[model samples]
Target: MTAEFWNGTMAAAAAAKQARVQVNAAYPITPQTHTVEYLSRFVNDGELDARLCKVESEHSALSACAGAAAVGARAFTASCSQGLALMSEVMYFTSGMRFPVVMAVANRTLSVPVNIWADHQDTLVNRDAGWIQIYTQTVQEIYDLILLAFRIAEHEDVCLPALVAYDGFILSHASEPVHPLDQAAVDAFLPPPGSADRPLLDPARPLQFGEVLFPDWYPDFELKKHRALADSLGTIRKAFEEFEAASGRRYAPVDAFATDGAEMVIVGLGSMMKTARHTAEKLREDGVRVGTAALRVFRPFPAEDLLEAVGGCRTVLVLDRDIGYGTGGMVYPDVTRILYHEDHRPDVLNFIVGTGGKDITPATIERCVELARGGYRGRVEFWPDARGAEEGVPYTEEPAAP
Candidate 1:
């Protein structure tokens, strides 16, 4: 197939169309609006034979999808940031019901003062919502992972919801060359609609869904869901291998670059890792043994794969785009916890960067490397120093020196 120019939204919409999604329910939200808009066009033009539910709110949109999935439909939806937060209540409901609903999250910062840009805060905050979270670095990955999310989510052993997230404007609005799979190829890769054998809320079968579970059964069911997510790691790996066999592209939970004999390795998730990898390569050229490892699968945590990637390095600099308020970087603690019990653990430093649309340039990553090399004492530090301003000055303005 020939490569076509597409932004992240188009790629995601194309993948959902190719997957033969039977139902798409979404309320328009920035960064995410373009994807649903494209899907709406596909449905209106008869290019895709799917029900387009224009819901009243993001919560209603996911509820519509969950209802569709409950009846054994191949359902999909897209939302990010505040929209995703609105969908939070239903997110747990959908996952608890074991619906194979797939959602595309255009990673955005949650608003307090209302800002729209790229960050992992929105999705990372929902990491424990029982949905398989997959982060992407490129438009092609957004396309591939959305397709794979359906396959993985619908798998009988992994009948849980999945989220494929990519940077909001960084990839969502930016165009890139993408070789999209044909419908035939996708149909071959993904099971035909209604092929998955699972308990569905059917009039004929009369299965109950979302029933109020008392405390006695609630904990057990929750345990089952937890085990299912943990066990789905193997199923996800199998799906990745199968997808690679079908398409010439390969994917893994953790993607490592130039880490063979590196002393310092940068670790991160989403689109910023592209910059981190480039920075690592440049540093290597300048006689600095730096490498990068990106976590593609965030929910399952991919601890072993990540351990293998950065285990040999002397220092692991974690570049997190989201802050955990009182705690620290969202991903930093996970990396530290994973390496804490290791026999030869690397020194891990967390640097929060690119919040609320701040650009994560190569220089930003270089600065992180410089700090890590200098044996910085702080466990967590914000790039560009959040406290750079004098007490009386606004953060946006330059501080007057004493």
Candidate 2:
């Protein structure tokens, strides 16, 4: 393994090269364009012998990847926000067809307000599209997960596409220390392209794919997809274990911090969790029993691990970078669904913060803790709320005077 400083985009490209990706089909999109660009450079330099296919649109980018994977080749792509929105149609088909194509999603906010910065709105909007979604908190995790995503997606028990999403601009541009495994170790870990275990699109096999199914059989296919995702949880754990054995760093479905005997807990996803962890530690020093839990894997839902992380707390503050409008924050509803079913559920509250790349300071987390302690549980609370209309300048990540 080699350790060096790498930005999230560079790390992803490095990981893809190490995985020996046979093809990379991608379109240029903000925050994600550099990943494929780096891969293209690698291919051109003869450092990595991969076919870099440049497509016109994000949809075609993923479609080309799906086509490559169907032909039993390892493929990758990268996009964010509008790019992902455009690719939504193919995203479902990619998973439904059981292609093991992996994509790096530098998550950004959606439109209507016309934003182009970091947020979970992009990925969460397509949460049910059937891809294995793993959110990363750092450049190292992003690199490591990209390597591991291939193994998870291509596993016989899974055979599903996976997405490694990180906050756009934040992790994407930020450089950090990363330990990347050598190609020798990676080759031993992953099977070569067009391996017999993967489905082939060769004329010799003459197999059909995505044939029109009648209504009677459509639901069965959907159910099988669900079952395959559920069953893949076991495979996910096995892959994490193997990765941990090879690398000294350990990973879990939920990354928990100082939860033991805590009175309250904060739950979130992606880059904000690093800030949350610091907030939790500061709160601990202030004699507040607070802990933080960041969800790593979103597709399988990691229900059991999440429950264990926040079950004992008096209140659980769920933070989200995006709101689901009338319903509230996305993670809040799901967390409540599981918590409400338990015999004794903690008071789980949802608060939306750091949307469109706003800095989620320690003070903001402190405010959340205070509100949770004060029994404030009603609607989705917006952070950095200033005197203004909903469609005003303050809503953006513009600096506001204290």
Candidate 3:
């Protein structure tokens, strides 16, 4: 793969700029703002042949995108946190109508106290929507994954909207060497939405897209969406294979590193997986058997790969940046899905870190291994406090800064 350097936000933003979209509409929010901003300039300066729409709000941004793509135009948008929540209704309608409108979400913690930081709560809340969701673990992955997202979402069989995300400040602002990707090569990979392919929006053959569905047909559509979601697992693998062939860099629903012979492992999504990988290597060097996996694609929850990856490990620790309110954390319950279904299960430890862009240092990872080894299975393991334990926090990547 060609190598280069870019911050996560820039990589993602540049991907949007590079991809051949026909129309762009979005309301800016921190972290996700750079994407639409770059596209707006791209359109203004004649770099891209597309309409750059200025919208009043997140809802209008998505509404415009849906309207454009419905008219046979390739469309996209980006936002996060409160902005995503604000467009939550339109988000559902966009997907239900089966428009291939792909969005980039800067995953962030929802505000009550008005904090601007990274978390998965905003995207996770829309998990029920009929959208194909994909998560990333690095800036490089973020750059590449968006390319895949468009091709997958626009496929005739899929026709589902896609949401690609990276943690807000963690990955969005975090710098990493990444390829900008060859635009000519990308065009070759994904040709413009050809006529025979899909979305017969020809005025000569006018069609009604989303008619009202009652109980009988609603269930069928819902079943179709469910099957399509399941179908995406295979589609993603096929897409990755194609991407690997084209880019020469392989990816998977679950990307594993050095798991063999390890007695324990850690699982996490977004950029925190990078910290977990470094922590694993350090633990291995210290004679503590360990390995790590970036739980890259959360939606079709890579059940097979995850089960196989951690099956041999006696202990597995999962880190969730978003808490499921009274349920401690989300990943634990999802992990329990496999742990319960499997004949063999690892002793899974749940750890929450980097909730609000708290630096997830290696020391905290080591401590987590120690705590799990010590047989501590507290539902919520708060991060260490120098003077006293903090109530709201589930765990810190390090001792709280004094």
Candidate 4:
């Protein structure tokens, strides 16, 4: 193990090299640019024995990775926001082909207004694209999960592409001390090249490629894919457990803090949940019963673990960084679905905050808890006094001048 001060981008690049990825197809984009930049340097320095393909666009980046994976090579790529949008079409094809390609997404807000900051909107748009999605809240988790992603995606029971996403700029640029595992340890955890549990395109064994399926057979093919996705939950758990045992860093699909005997629970994803946890601790000091729930694995959804975490609470407050357009925040609907059939589920409130990398401080978290106490009747609630946001001031409190 090696502990060093590293940002998310460096951590991701380092993790990829340690995981022994054979090919990295990349195109520079905000926040995610440093990830590939670091990888390129690693390859140049002869530290990583891999092929780095500098592509023209994000679409071509993922397409190149898919091509490499087709030839039984361990492949990786990184993107954010518009980059993710461009790669969307290829993303579905990669999953449908059952290629175990791993991608790192620096989650950012989508365009039209032309904002490039931290938000979940980009990845949420492709939620049903048949790829496993994992969100990391800290720099350490970013490094650890990217390493684990290869193992989980290449598992025989789940040969699907996976994306490890973290808040753009927030987690991506913020530096922290991470104890990265040595290459030997990672090699032990993952399979070598051409030995992954996925179908390959070797010339020796000529096989039919992804042919157009007739209507009669298409549904069954999709059904089987869906079943594989559902069964991946067990594989995810097993990988996390093994990683924890080897590294002594515990992780879970749904991570809960002080939820046992709490009256109110705040549920969210990414680094904002760390802020919520701090707020929960202060609220507890004030004799308030509060807890925090952070969803790590977004794709598998971890409905059972989520229900177990918040089932005893009197109220569940969902804080989302992305919206679902016509309905409400993306995560809110999922939470409601988990408790939909329960006769005595807690009242759930949804608040969309921190879009486009708006600051979500401890004060903001406190405000959310207070609002939830007063009761909310709306489907989705924005930050209180959101008119200021329309005027370019998203945060209620201004930072003190130096």
Candidate 5:
């Protein structure tokens, strides 16, 4: 293993190369462009033996990857925000066809006002796209999860696409030390491309993909896909265990910090969770029983692990970077639902923060803890107010009550 100073985008690119991806078809987009650019450079320098298919648009990019996966080859791509929106149609096609293509998403805010920065809206909105979603907090997690994504996605029992999402500008641009596994180790961990059992588009033995099915049979296919995704949890955990053995780094679906016997806990995704964890430690110094739980695996939902993490707390404060509009934050409802059926449910609160690249500082987390402790009346509130704040307004001030 060699440790080097690398940004999240570079970490993703390095892992894809190590995985020996056969095809990369992606369009250039902000925050995510660096990943595809690095891959192109690798291919050009002969460092990675792969086909770099430059496409006209994000739609074409994912379509190209789907085609490559259809031929039973390992494929990769990177996109964010609008780029991800453009790939929405092909996203379902890739997953429904059971193609184990891997994609790196630099999570960014979607547009109306046109902003480019870190947020989870892009990936969260596409949560039901049938692709396995894994959110990363640090640059190292980006590298590690990308490699693991390929291994889990291609498992014989779970033939599904997977996405590794990291905060767009925060993790994507920030440089950090990452220990990249040696090529020999990576080769041993992941089988060669096309080794997994998948329906190959062979000339001698033809198979149909995206075939029209009557209503009677359609639900069965959907149910099968759902079951496959749910069963993938075992594959994911096994991959995590094997990777830790090989890399000496451990990962879990839900990462908890100082949650034992806590009265309150902060729950979130992406880079903000690191800050929340730090705030929790500081709060502990002040004799506050606060903890943090970061959701690593967003899709197979990890409902069981999440229940174990925050279920014991008296109050669970869910911090969301993406707003679900009428319903509040994207992740808030999910947390509430997970706890609603439990007999020991806590008082769950949702605070939508850091939307459109706004900063989610330690101060923001402190304020959230304060409000939760004070028994704030609203179930859902926006930090810094969704309505434009006056210039120089502090983030700690409570937003208009929900």
Candidate 6:
């Protein structure tokens, strides 16, 4: 059945409806707070057989997920912004220990003024934490990816954590149509959970999952995690295929729009991307020569696919919702890296926009494209937040004060 513009509150409730989740541990935060509220109602209504863990903080929420997952329970949790940052240190432990837990990150901007709004800073900030991160552009992806995340994360080849992310108020609260799936469909797609391969925990084995190890074997352990992540890419592709084969819904590592035979390309992530797309069509009709690429998979970086899309571009603009603090935008660094190793790399531009959920309209994207072709010669340009951004213009972060 199709979802009728259901809010994120009901979407979260849908999770309990679809998955056989055993424990849900979360601390309330804006935008995503309703997710927990709906999930709690599911637990109370007998629709879901789950233990509602009202933790004191986000740290405890994830900690519970790790513990429960280790002992073989379909654990779930959600958090954002400061909450994700607060659990930053322990995020290492959870993934390093290899627990098949899945989380829904309501992507939000980090704060100095402490604002709660949609942005990828929080999720991008934890990019190297060894989790399989996927961003869904639609509400149905949110519901489906959560279920798919469980299957992919728990696979023996990919014993890692996964984050099913979508922008906060943008995707979370915005009403959109989604195809809701039944519990039986989800079960068939996911298969029976054998994460630990037994009932709960068996004292007979008395295994030690987490322990301090010396440096000699640490490198080997770390290497294995690396291999698993790389291997999981194949498994990820497989899972997407399985989802499409069974559900008739498609997904990709990188979702592109009108990229065929274009001289220039624009890259976008999260909700701002939708705006860029609308402007791109107008630019294309005006014969300005442009294409737009959406980054569906951020963690894996989609290097091979990204290189193919922007391979022949004369100019590229990488729009980011958050600055990389000291650097310009995060995508600029990686884009430049992609070009450096290749024989042909385009003139890449970086603009940090929508830092605190500022409005990013089609006009903003149009202006950006215009400035990009202005014959500026530089690798980086720190746009004046969103309000002062200029397209095709060349500028870099000014030198630090002496």
Query: Top lDDT: which candidate number?
Result: 5
TM-score of 4: 0.95
lDDT per model vs. reference: 0.89, 0.87, 0.79, 0.88, 0.90, 0.78
Among all candidates shown, the one with the greatest TM-score: 5
lDDT of 4 by residue, 239-312 (tens): 99999887888999998999999999999989999999999999999999999999999897899889889999
- Ten residues in sequence with the least summed lDDT for candidate 5: 393-402
Clashes of each: 0, 0, 4, 0, 0, 7
Q: Rank the candidates by TM-score, best first.
A: 5, 1, 4, 2, 6, 3
What C-alpha RMSD separates each model from the true structure? 3.2, 3.7, 3.7, 4.3, 2.1, 3.3
Q: Evaluate residue 269 in candidate 6 and report its C-alpha lDDT on the 0 to 100 scale.
A: 81
Q: List the residue pairs that clash in candidate 1.
A: none
lDDT of 1 by residue, 121-178 (tens): 9999889999999999999999999999999999999999999999999999999999
Native-to-model Cα distance after best TM-score fit, residue 368 in candidate 4, in Å: 0.8
Please write out the lDDT profile of model 2 over residues 1-402, one tens digit for every residue: 658899999999999999989989999888888898899999999999789888999999999999998888899999999999999999999998999999999989988688778989999999999999999999999999999999999999899999999998899999999988878788877777667386678898888888899999889989999999878888989999999887767999899999888899899999989998999998899899999999999888999989899989888899988878766689888798889889877877777888887878898788778767776554435444332455643232322222
lDDT of 2 at 352: 80
Tell how far residue 312 is off in model 4, in angstroms. 0.9
Ordered list by lDDT, greatest first: 5, 1, 4, 2, 3, 6
Pairs of residues clashing in candidate 4: none
TM-score of each: 0.95, 0.94, 0.92, 0.95, 0.96, 0.93
Native-to-model Cα distance after best TM-score fit, residue 395 in candidate 5, in Å:
9.8
Q: Write the per-residue lDDT of candidate 3 for residues 1-402, one digit (tens) a residue.
A: 377777776777677766778778889898788887778777888888888889999999999998887777778889999999999999889877888888888898898878788888888888778788888988888888888888788877777888898989888877888865688778766657423166655688888777788887788988887787767788788888998887888998887887887788788777778878888888888898988877777777788888878888888888778777776667778887787777777777777666766767787777777766765543434443112345544344332232
TM-score of the candidate numbered 5? 0.96
By TM-score, the better pick of 5 and 6 is 5
Q: What is the lDDT of candidate 1?
A: 0.89
Minimal lDDT window, size 10, model 3: 378-387
